[model samples]
Target: MPLLRPRDGSAGDAQIPATSAAEVAEHTCAAEAVFHSGVWSGLDPRERAAALLRLADLMERDADHLAALECADAGKPLRECVENDVPGAIESVRWFAEAVDKLTGQSFPAGPGVLALTEREPYGVVAAILPWNYPLAMAAWKIAPALAVGNSLVLKPADTTPRSVLHVEKLALEAGIPTGVLRVLPGTGAEAGEALARDPRIGALSFTGSTRTGRRILTAAAETNLKRVSLEMGGKSPQIIFADALVYGEDLISQTIESAFLTAGQNCTAGSRILVHTDIAEEFTRRFVAAASALVLGDPEDLDTDIGPVIGGGAATRMLAAVEEARAAGARVLLGGTEVPVVEGGHYVAPTVLDRVPAEARILREELFGPIVTIQTFTDEAEAIALANDTPYGLAASVWSAQIDRAIRVSRAVRAGVVSVNSYSEGDLTSPFGGWGESGFGGVEKSLRAFEQWTREKAIWVSLHG
Candidate 1:
């Protein structure tokens, strides 16, 4: 079959025009230098803010076109693109636009006879590598703040979803971002991604993707220029439900199924592990299976569709292999275990739920990264906490209980970075979002700490004159 190509002459493969590794490296390095030496990093806070606002406006105006391109590239629901992805991306730009002027450096009290102050300076050129899932939103997280702080960026979108990056670049250009300040290089990670990572001209790197790839990038950063690297990687997040939880009956069943199955469970923050009290495990599993079994799987463009295909063929095969391995290891397949019908000829997997998963199973230890959740039971709170933290991942988790104290206690006890009480994976622009352990390091935009990652604090001291 012929590969699908966008009107811009870019596709999953064959996107980059560079014919050699040296050419790719040279182009990426030149773009990074241009951005660092140009107006992007030199603009005043207000000017940078205005540029961001214009970018947001352009994103809003082109929401439909970009969303369609995103859906085509990612196989996600088109409605999700318009309702969630595009709006979220635009809001990120707007938030950072307004936040630039408000973001200020700190001054410390100097000892007698000396004056001291600290100022945040942009980290020169930044390389932002975005994943396929939620491409625009991830890009916005890196782009908005990096630009707002007056740093130029070089972006590389995932191999399967480069069109959205091009679309975003075009929007930024339309929004008056000066040329060479923001450039999109669409190619394989081995080529364009590594080139950007190893380039000495790029001062910092922000990545959102799998842990294996993140580790590789980190190694590259260390071996090459030792640049500042911020990574948001994989997760096998847990959603614990206590006996006294408010979501006991119908709500528990519904929320658990939806949270795990959203985006076909491709979300890094998806509630893949359901920890239920021993007394309620069977009941929870039954309801969860029923709800998940009923989800409508079809064309992503269909407004009524509840689920869509996995991002690509390799992902779908991996998900299916996990399911088969779990079943082979004596786990019960309570819901789906195969693909469903789709309008487009692409990869799709049904929402699946595996019950009685053992600790030793690969599905339990590793991120399934698909619409598959494993249910486990514990007799006590300590056991529940132990079960939740068993995996190497510590990205996000949730605790459900009617008693606020129980929820609070469990929320604090969980090893993940972001934990919710009585809810699942609700992140906003005002809050910080990142991971712990193997999930990766450094939070992205919205968090006050995120700004620090993009900047280097320079302390200035002056001796008092006699």
Candidate 2:
């Protein structure tokens, strides 16, 4: 049996159960039938909203159990999964639930004796392909709004991180969500994910993972139904540092490294690159490296551990090899860049900081999705902006500056989807979360805009003369 393992590298007794093509076909067919029945959508919008709220209530009630499942399954730090992911996901469910009824439509006078009103309706079925890093939270990010707007959903979680989503899907059903209304298929992306993506009955598709996988999903959709697709993919985001923000050297160090190292740097929004002004480069680099090296890496079950392990041995080997390749190319290694053997069974990578990294270094340009960060120096504002925008990704970035005008200008000029000034943020529930370029084709996940992705618009026309 192919078992799902914890960060300690110990596989749980649970096997990687195979889900069949027939099963996927059956699930899609059922989801379509649910949409047509309109049992969910026909409910006064408030009832749909209430269903979501009930799900949120169940989430809170089961918070401790869910948090433990996420920690053991995905190798995430237990504290963060509980403090952030679980609660944050519950809040998202509630937020979209509240906003569902308030999303009004448009009406206009067309021509003589004609009137037109526009309505936004659910797309029937949506496929959400979630990544392993933030399993439970990412699932909530997609399904909360998708369900609130009355669309039936099919969730395909990463093979390595299926337990949490599967656990929650049961909670959702117990909260009165109809069985066909939400289906969780636990299997590999190669089989189940592709099946879901190519299924013509799936009204829309949403994915959060690597750029390579995102491209494959896009191709699959085009070759099949060409269903509406929304992707939140990979990022090699940069954090730009200015001289003025260094007035409190500790503040800059604290915020930037925290963003980079969270989830042991397995986040798509990880600020993997730090572009600093030539003037402040020395001080900023010093403080940043110091904080990174001090991070506690141990068994995630221990709350005192700052970070757990990467997903498994393969991730640790790949992340470390990238660092060695950079070192061989003459980049200066400041800290970390190796694995921590002290943490038993789970894969533990030492948080690494490198400077003078050649532009050609694979670690500098690609998303390592581990606790690795690279530093570079820029001579002026123009150079900083140019270097920051040089990558194919435009997912997220952070800018630190005391000058409000400079901060505002840089924030506007950067090509990223989300930019934070002076602080590091995963972004807010009220705003749209998405990216551009190879980071994604452009789709927002949260807030009012996300409702648009799961639902389609229709025009109602009437002839007053009749």
Candidate 3:
């Protein structure tokens, strides 16, 4: 067991077990056995839904504790963990649980004495490799749907932030989900994650992480069982601010700030690139810089804190280095781009805004995954659309324009999985969330569409004339 500390450098008592590849193999084998036993995978859909609902209740009951663990393990602001992540996770579970009975098969008329039908059945065993940024919430994204569809799941929480999800596994069992049905393996990506990816017993795998790692997982799958893989990877998402949108002023600025820096901008769909119409560029930049500078960066445990440290010292160093590199490449640093020593040993980078960042800058093309945003001016809608779609990644984008025609036009043109018009959002659970280009592959997460990733459709045919 290794002592895991919070990103805020606060003392943490959680002991994270470093699971080995052999352990991962054992767990996958156990999950497969349980999947075959019918204790879970063959149980009534309503029964599985009932157990999941109970699990949701237990999570809500222990919301405070869960939020605390999230704050500690992931260095998320206490307010964010309590108000957003924990609640969002609970809602995800509830939504999926309630949807269990509603997810139906199809019937088709084969004419005469022939019958034809299709049914969605769960893959015997599935694996979900979660990211550290939103441990609890992302876990629910995969876990709830997989369980609802009656699959035994092997969950591999990110090495840095395993506490919250490990706790979730306990609650799942207490809520009547069988022991082997929901197994949590907390370990590094190379060992346990790779083991899960390459194991033939894992019929399906869903991962949310960097693009590079997603490629590795795909390769592993290809070499082994050729298992079904669904990936939601990186993003250099753009937020285009057209002149007409400035009428919303304060509201626009506030929403854009959240889009850019939420979760310290480690979000996969973070709107890191801002493309403003040159007509209103100066005004928008001024307001954006002011609000970004005012964010309260401090210990994640404090309720008043608006920003917390990045995952660790290494993350802080990388973010700051990227900022300096951008400046050296001729970008103007409009606001805080320096490290904030909020506490001894805590990793904090001030909310940073860069103006007139060169198009060729690495910071513009790469996913920095920090509270740093870059701004560029586009003279027209076509240019804005071009700039928005320029990046190799396209998980999410935001189009701000009061003009309906312009908004609709740009939204359609921008290459992204999810686009927000006049505001910033990844949409609610009802909308399917994934990416385009390098940002995603295989399948999307959330809504009814998510169920498709965990299941296989079987078409049955029979003749009544016999």
Candidate 4:
């Protein structure tokens, strides 16, 4: 066993004894045998549903401990972990618990004297490689549905945040998940991640990370058994604000700030590129910058901390490079764009606002996963739609206008997986969440739609006389 150090590259957490490549293969093979044996999959669907509900119950019981571990490991706000992350994780599992039983097969008459029906069955074992942010919630998104559909799972937690998922594995077993049904492999992309992706035994591989790594996972799978692959990749999502909306709307400034800077802008759906109609661009820029400047950047463990450190020093360095690159390209920094004062190893970047960044600027186009936002102006609805849809990446987008018709038209025009109107929400558990374009290929990850990712449909034909 290799030691999996749980550090955010700033300070180190306790070492997690990691499984090696060979061990990962061994575990996946064992999980495959268990899955093929049908010890779990053979159970009634209701029984599978019951097991997940029990796991949800256990998770709720351990919510405080899990939330604390997430904050300590990932440096996300403790308040967010409690209010959003943990609760969201629990709710996701519970929703799948109920959905598994309700999910139905189809039957139809095929012409005369023949009957046709369809059966939905699980892919034997699924391998999920998840990122450090939203560690437990991501686990819930992948783990709950895979299990609900009667597939075994090999979960490889990010190197930076391994503690919570391992604890989750334990909780699953305690809630009566069979042995070998779920394995948590804690190691790097080179080791455990590669082993899981290339293994011929894995039926599907779902990853949530950078687009760069998503390409690697896809190619690696291609070389092997060509396992089913799903990726939820990067985003430079835009928040298009029309002058009509801002002119009459109350609290528009506050709402826009929430969309851009929540989770310190680490969210993939974050509206980092704000497109304002030129008529109200100046006033909106001033209000947006002032509001962004007032955000409190402090220790994540505190309830009052609005913006915490980035995941690590390297992440902060990348963000700083982006800011400098933007400045060098003639983009003006309207608010904080420098590194925050820090002790020996804490990685903090000030919440930055760039004024009317040119369309060609790096800050305007690239996905910088930090508390940095850039504004650009559009003269008309067509220009706003063009600007919002300009990026190669299209994971999420938002259109703001009091006019429902115009908002809907703009939302449709933006080439993204998820588009919100007026409000900025990451959709609920019942909504399907996935992406389009360089955002990578995948079926939805939540709601009834997620069942598509975990199962394949088999059509059956029968003679009526038989």
**What is each predicted model's overall lDDT from 0 to 1?**
0.81, 0.87, 0.90, 0.87
Candidate 2, residues 310-393, lDDT tens digits: the string is 988988899999999999999998998888785667878899999989988788788899999999999889999998998999
What residue runs in model 2 are displaced by over 4 Å at the alpha carbon?
Answer: 1-11, 109-111
Choose the strongest candidate by TM-score.
3
**Local accuracy of candidate 1 as per-residue lDDT tens digits, 335-439:** 888876665566778888888766689999888789988899988889999999998999999898899888889889999889987777556877888889999
Q: Which of candidates 2 and 3 reaches a greater TM-score?
A: 3
Q: Model 1: runs farther than 4 Å from truth?
A: 1-20, 36-38, 246-250
Question: Lowest summed lDDT over 10 consecutive residues: which window, candidate 4?
Answer: 4-13
Instruction: Please report the candidate that would top lDDT against the real structure.
Output: 3
Model 3 over residues 309-343: C-alpha lDDT tens digits? 88888888888898899899999999889887895
TM-scores of the candidates are 0.94, 0.97, 0.98, 0.97
Candidate 3 ranges beyond 4 A from true positions = 1-8, 11-13
Pick the winner on TM-score between candidates 3 and 4.
3
lDDT of 4 by residue, 392-448 (tens): 898898888989999998888889989988878779988988999988777688889
Per-candidate total of colliding backbone pairs: 0, 3, 0, 0
Report the C-alpha displacement of residue 147, candidate 3, in angstroms: 0.3
Give model 3's TM-score versus the native structure: 0.98
